[model samples]
Target chain A: MTTDTIVTAAMLAIGDELLSGRTKDKNIGHLADLLTISGIDLKEVRIVADDEEAIVAALNGLRGQYDYVFTSGGIGPTHDDITADAVSRAFGVECIHDPDAMTLLGDMYARRNMDFTEARRRMARMPNGSTHIPNAVSTAPGFVIGNVHVMAGVPQVFQAMLEAVLPTLKTGATVLSRSVQSPFGEGDIGGPLGDVQKAHPQTSIGSYPKFDGTSFSTELVIRARDETILAAAEADVRAMLEGIAASRRT
Target chain B: MTTDTIVTAAMLAIGDELLSGRTKDKNIGHLADLLTISGIDLKEVRIVADDEEAIVAALNGLRGQYDYVFTSGGIGPTHDDITADAVSRAFGVECIHDPDAMTLLGDMYARRNMDFTEARRRMARMPNGSTHIPNAVSTAPGFVIGNVHVMAGVPQVFQAMLEAVLPTLKTGATVLSRSVQSPFGEGDIGGPLGDVQKAHPQTSIGSYPKFDGTSFSTELVIRARDETILAAAEADVRAMLEGIAASRRT
Candidate 1:
């Protein structure tokens, strides 16, 4: 894709553990940051349980809306690992044991002198007409069907799979951002920051309040795809903070 | 709700920073764990941007499906902070400055000797017919309208608001969980775990793979509302692990 093209993406994190709060998700933020730097706009994220219907529905919902969909979790050998089947259902394709995946897994298990049991063999299954995403951390590869990239739930495997998948996707304009830390709280600069944001329509400005044990402060962030526009917005935000500081001093 | 009744909930996290990867979300997992213990099933979580249309659409989509909906972020004083307006639009109600919230904020600013500007006043606005969810950490109150509870983005404030809202919620049967640590990897236990899951249909058994730097292990979790079912499932899982260990030793 051209640099100016706007590529969008959504993440679907599938696991009953995530929904049950047994596991706090680390993949969503990791994927979001990677997509942002790769110049893809991450528009939305959904975390659903391992139930096949829920996974299928969420996959269909996100796959249609964004340019790319990345899913983590539910690709293991366990019964609850149903993401591949759900993705196949979403795409109206057959879930099958891919020969390439089977061979890779078989070789790895043979080298380790471990029996490739039926449960371990389950990892070779993927949606038909899908290509495997090689995992450096694990032998069982993730698969990509249509625009959905399915990866493992383990953080290391997920990150390794992403490394393999990211290079293949099309990218858009890289967003640039500038942050201004203000000793003043949001209450002090919110009005002026709002005005600055309106004036610099090219920039998306955000005000985040931070509370230390004793007091509060604000961090103003200005983001844009264009460096010139981003710099302009940053200047305005800094001026706004200075104005507040000066008034307080006087 | 009665003890046996299944009370489900969904969380909507509204912010641009979350999607941009500028900020990692802590509230989703926090809320998920809290709800799980309080007997509320957290079925789904969606993270959307700061845009008004996106917020309203997501809010509407979730509020009808779940018994309770919790939203964090986008209620700050900046221009991009538009969750309050979006929630009002979702409910087709006018967002007005609640007198109680206004007085509360006004008194807070007065006590701190800070100017109560229009931006600070914006925090007092909520949908009509909404009751405030008090924030002990900060004076700006969160609010509850219909089944939706909107709270702050800051972890401290969000937690304080949750403390105030949790007691008012209707709860279901407290789900009890048992986790068995397996020395073997998921590959070894998946088949037997699936069997245990099928036999003990009353419990939901999940296999999660854990990787240290060198090797992989597994954690099997069994959850059920009934203690007897949970115990039975745990026993089966332990037996399965023991069988694997015995076979390997021989």
Candidate 2:
């Protein structure tokens, strides 16, 4: 298998508040950034609810398709937190409080002489035969069962934990990116952009035309591994957009 | 069922750039806002890549579990723009360019004298037997195959499309929301919050602690349908938060 072929990952962002507009789920973006730097292809990203069936289905689908699966949220202290149970159900593994997770959590609270109640200790539960992904920022540790890495929903904590675990992951080829932005709609750029793409079949050029109330702007993106090819592709995109912009001006 | 029975919905955010952190998706928040007003419980939100398999799997998972599904992204002129096709595949329909969609689309371009190329024409190709979701901002449209509503990934366009279509949606009794922010970490509020939650079993309270650089604050949200019960829960949350904030002052 080639570097491009080896590793592909999926993100599962799980939360109810995220869907309610109460909170923006930032964990997926963070994981995406971290995973990409480590050369893991973030092939899929999913934001699912706290529901058992939905989470189970997503976990199964992603695990079956990709090399690694990273799930964030529904692993908190609330009643809505159901990731552990659902993951256990998905893998058919026993969902029990792992000793290592409990010890870490206990030490965290014991250092301050705080009560680690049943609810707080709920964070210690892990799918059987899985390793705990340490929580550096918080005591609640995420765990790995099969290919799925269960993580925190909180942004800072999620990033820190992912950084810790990413080093151990098998990586794919690092995806390279370059872009060109212009004050025009995508339609104006499509025809020429398509021609450029037809030439550089290896590179993926994306035209993102944004329309605000005032005016429209198009951000053309060229993504690939080869620097020379990416640069060549980007030059063509710039030329196409410039030609369109020049024509529109006239 | 009862007004107490929850009405659930899922958000499907489809984009590869979002997974790269190259773009932070804001449509989930917009969808959440719109769904909240309609008494539709935004149960889950998912972000997928530009790949067709990812989109199709997400659609199946969300559509199977939730009462309704709203998908955003992959509905543009680019080659990776495949949300409509994936939805078609998910519903097992022949992904065809419908005649009605073509008529509306033709009329849209006829007014402007713009040549509708294959890429532009692709926008009009929705699932067979799907309903057209009119785009107020752009002539390029979204469609509804079953209960799932396909919308644009752009925030403004997504919100506009949702507003246009939501009125016709089958919504339930309005969900009431009340929140109180405390200058404390979630851990600090966890104990008392647990007690309050136990006492008010009818209401579901969500705690989100935000760290703004130097200090931390938690927003405690209480949501339910019954007006009197919602008010009572709000008062309790306010009292608890005020107690914490007042104690901090001393």
Candidate 3:
């Protein structure tokens, strides 16, 4: 894949539970890893409350900016499960109970001898002109409206839905990263490190510092689509750290 | 505090680690809980990468909209720790090494026989005309420039710095929430729940559903600054669920 062939995606985490500090979102990281591995650069993430206006605004902002916008939560069989409706409003489409979703859910409930209640029927609703994203774990399948892929809030079900959706999407070149840990502290090597970063215009370099009880250490990470440039930048970073550490010893 | 005197805050979590999915953010939830207790509405959250332009844009956007803007991560002694510089640029100020910060770090390092090197001295830097937000976990303090409160990335240090900063800020009436769990599924009671929500427009009602192996249950939460309204809304929600459950039984 060419260096310029980069794909990007954004995520909108829809839940009052997340914003209320009741639920620590595990889906963002999980989705980020999946997107990165599949060569799609995960650009931005926004977490909004379960309010329709908030979800609609966030969805519009993200779907316009990124190739794919994934939404998690608020698609359950409840009053607060308004993600599908909000997404529909964002895309200027009517939310309808898709017949396919109804059949799938109806069959699942019948097999289990469970009541196909009205609330359960709500799960069959999706925005008009959209298609279902299969749910391997749960019968309540998620749907895709425009560029947005609406998925379950439950981690297991979300992961399963993502696995199903990924195969059909277009993927770009893999963005790889290399990390070099330096025994020397960040302050000890910041100048030379910045110089190395300035020299490698194509690669993005990051310095993460940790202060143990006695001393400071740093992990220098370099990311790029091209392995050759990335390796070259990583070498420069390593040399810069070594020179700093050597000068400090003397 | 009057009901009209509600305050709002926004958070910006900076770092490539968070964007790359290498680091799971613990600060957003921590700050959300603190802000909620202090009656500050956390209006929005944005997670941006370690790019200076991204940080500056987010800072400008958030600080302009909210009463308070809090930043987490990227304020360390490293090349990648460019939050202070970005914030300075965002506010059109110079980043300077404050005298108090120099003294604090100098004394701390001196006691431990560690070199107060140039890179280490970088920790003393803050935006011009800014006051240091003391860090109890580490001597390297965070700072506040304009309405933005820049805090450390480490969870322990971030919490300590926030504790130090919160006491100095103006706080509002404590917003409270009451939750009632109903054995009835969301689908069973969504219509009535929506009606109750419309009737109690003052209180924000949320319906969260959980599907156990056998059936679905819902947690209906009502939040408001006024206890009377919140309690009244909670009662309406409870009655709505009870009526639905009773109807289903018959």
- For each candidate, the DockQ is 0.84, 0.46, 0.55
Off by over 4 Å in 3: A1-3, A211-215, A239-250, B1-3, B211-217, B235-250
What is the C-alpha lDDT profile of model 2 across A36-56, one tens digit per residue?
Answer: 777787877767667799899
On lDDT, the stronger of 1 and 3 is 1
Whichever of 1 and 2 has more lDDT, that candidate is 1
TM-score of chain B of 3: 0.96
lDDT of 2 by residue, B1-250 (tens): 3854667888788887887778877887877887888888887677777878878887887798888888888887767777878888899989898898788878877888987767677778888998888887886778888989998888778877887888888788877888877676666667677778877878878877575655446777888888888888888877887887787799
Q: Lowest-lDDT window of 10 residues in candidate 2 chain A?
A: A182-191
Model 2 spans > 4 angstroms off:
A1-5, A239-250, B1-6, B92-113, B116-118, B181-199, B212-217, B231-250
Q: Over the stretch A1-250, how does candidate 3's per-residue lDDT look in tens digits?
A: 5645878788888887777676678899999888888988888888888889999988887798889999899898766788989999998889999999999999998998877878788999999888999987667899987788999988888899999999978888887899899887776677778789889988888887776755667778899888999999999988887787688789
Instruction: Looking at model 3 chain A, report the run of 10 residues with the lowest lDDT sum.
Output: A208-217
Clashing pairs in 1: none
Q: Provide the global lDDT of candidate 2 against the true structure.
A: 0.79
Q: What is the C-alpha RMSD of each candidate to the true structure, in Å?
A: 1.5, 3.5, 2.8
Candidate 1: where is the Cα deviation over 4 Å? A1-4, B1-4
What class would a CAPRI assessor give candidate 2's docking? acceptable
- Alpha-carbon interface RMSD for all candidates, in angstroms: 0.8, 2.5, 2.1
Error of 3 at B35 (Å): 1.3
